[model samples]
Target: MSPNTSAGSKQHLAHSHAHEEDIPGTVNLNAAEGDDTGYGQALFPVPAEDPNDPLQWSNFKKTMILIICSFYSFLANAALIGPSPYIDLWAEEFDISPTKASELISYPNLAFGFGSLIFVPLYLKIGRRPVMLISLIIFCAGIIGASQCTTYGGLMAARVIHGFGSCVCEALPVQLVNDIFFLHERGERIGYYTVCLCLGTFASLPAGYILAGGYGWRLFFYVEFAFGAALLVLAFLFVEETSYDRKSAILMSMPATESEKASEVMGSQVLAEISETRIPPRKSFAKTLSLWGRVDNDVPFFTMMARSFTYFLVPQALWVIASFGINIGLLALAYSYTFPILITSPPYNWTVINSGLFAIAAVVGYALAVPFTSSSDRLAAYFTKRNNGIREAEMRLGVMLPAMLIGPAGIILYGVVAEKSLHWVLYFVGGALSYFAAYFYFSFTLAYAVDSYHSNTSEMLIAMNLGKQYVLPNIALILPL
Candidate 1:
């Protein structure tokens, strides 16, 4: 397909071909169809002539948007799970079973995942910034509602509302990260976000202790409410649209052809061209917020949603499922939930007040593992360079070998400790070891997926997000503690 056949005037090219490798660019959708779009213009996913594609943005812009959105994920997760310590209080006040009280966390968690089914494609279609800002507003209202609720149903509804809104933060950050980052840079960046998301457990330890200090469980809600409100303001002021033309890679990869030939090749490409000539000319905060800043009408909300489901067939997506499920199921759910409950009762007899202290072990473990967070990226990049610029997606998995053995060993030790009533310190040691090992699996799995599937990062993210949600809740509630 020739570039001119696309409907819109060419504003920019796709970033897939921007990297410094050959046989290296994304899978060219246009080239696959044997189009004659200029080799310089072909993009990986091969956007039509639109400039609004998320893939075309500068690294700094993408990074800022990613960091903000990922932090939003961190906060939203914290709000839902942080109140676990207060579940007993809620149970006592409402005269509900411990399991029912736990629903405050579990049901919201389910909502958290399902929310993505609704919003992921919307953001992919409509643009990330607008969806994010709107979601944050709804999230804020949900938090405020939870703070005011006096009944179990009211609180549960509020929690569901909050979880649903917050779910976007999780999926969107990964999607945005996939959208903008290069294969070499993605692992470390996603690792950073995953750290924040995982630390919700560690953060909740102290969140629980706050109740023992007499602030009461309601204070936790208040604290989360305050942070949500602040994050909302920050997002509105800082986030910009992230969707962009998907054609540059295809145009860039194919050899150039005459204009007449290009027109014959691009039958559907013209339909994809965006009408906007410029991106609202990067403006100041006040100007950016004005209703005058036009929204793109070409947003393909439903199409984006429909396409995301196809990620299940991608190999990288399965790896993400295994990596994310094992890491979160083990460290976040199995270890984090079980250790506290076990140590606080039976032979250990530790007080509920101090049960949350074990999260310190988890934090320490992950902290120790932090130095190695970028090892996968470095190793993959090094190997990619060694191959004379031929990039294979599996290069990063070697760095995870050490983690695979170490994590399962920690699990065994924890099981023994719980079964035999060993010293409580063994619990800490085992949990710490598992958490440290999980760092590698959690960090690199995502990088591998991003590198492997060069075209659709959002699709992979959707799968990973859903995987985490399904695994965490099942392990946390159904399996044991």
Candidate 2:
């Protein structure tokens, strides 16, 4: 057969298999008729014919965007949590209680989440690229402003501004993943983003070392400012608008069958008319760089915000929020604040600077877990194959079970060691175990949630950010008390 004929035959077969449904919360990946990316036999939410379809972009372009957004997630989170080592220093300088000083981190963390309510809807209505750019600019400005703040109030204000601005960092990366990647790729890709986000907690280690050098807390913000500025430029240059209206795309329809075509010659004419109406010409690079995207008239911004609150009722979304909150609030924040004080006390008598070294355990934990980032994706794919190409969202969640217990155990270990003044190494072991488990929970739960739900992803993200932020700060505050 001719090469064109072979290709057409394969495409037709792929289309025939595409309409088959898997169990709820799953996708069919029996791409026996299509291209295989190694993880699956087929694609879900199949690519559009337009070259501008994000899934159709070259792997290099996709990787670049992922790298940029992942880096942004890193910076935003680092800026939020990196200041933990400075709580004591700030308290001494500002003549406030340690709790008050910690509030600087806690309150800003709240803003970090609340920022999404505004930006998520704005992106849904306007475009992801523009909102990201605007947020980065605001983030850079806030960082710069923070570095110059001499007063406690001034610094807090600056932190809040940056926190709110960079808040989209949490949600945007996931949205971009949903927009650009295939279902098979989402779990692995989100794992990469989650790794970066988790690594941001390690920033406290370096932040402590910087202050130990007597460079001061403000210097940390200065460094953040520099990176934020660089990231802003990179994002503007590389992150294209991914907010396509798939409903209006012609390729969203199923392929016409030969039998249907044979029934009427006018069927072909009708298909052509539909394609013409649905597909627009791909925009040039320069046009894509334009500050504006065509506003989506169907997106109701306020209604989206209102509906986001309802996602809290979703089991998967609630799980994600709980996973993040417990990890961040009870485990991470608790350890960051307490370890310094405990270690620097008489029994341990470690240098104040060395307190942040506890984050090294976090580093080790995440580094170890990094290799398993794709485990859920692989597992889901495996289960899909066994189920005759039917994939379930629950298939990816089995990996999370081990993490669920491991995290709390580590937290308990840390508490016991701290309470008993046991060997300092026990602290590290506890932290490492907790963080290792946290990695699985963080990466897979979010992936599972996304896979399970096919609704407005941005709204779900808003709900997640809000839920975690609200729950985390209260936990952080209570733990410190």
Per-model C-alpha lDDT, please?
Answer: 0.70, 0.80
Error of 2 at 63 (Å): 0.9
User: How far is each candidate from the true structure, as Cα RMSD in Å?
Assistant: 7.9, 4.5
lDDT: worst 10-residue window of model 2: 9-18
User: Residue-wise lDDT of candidate 2 within 45-128, one digit each (tens)?
Assistant: 656556677766657778889999999999988999899878888899989999899889888888998889899999888888
Residue 387 Cα positional deviation in candidate 2, in Å, after optimal superposition: 1.1
Instruction: Return the lDDT, model 1, position 191.
Output: 84
lDDT of 1 at 47: 37
Assess candidate 1 and give its TM-score to the true structure. 0.79
Point to the candidate with the largest lDDT.
2
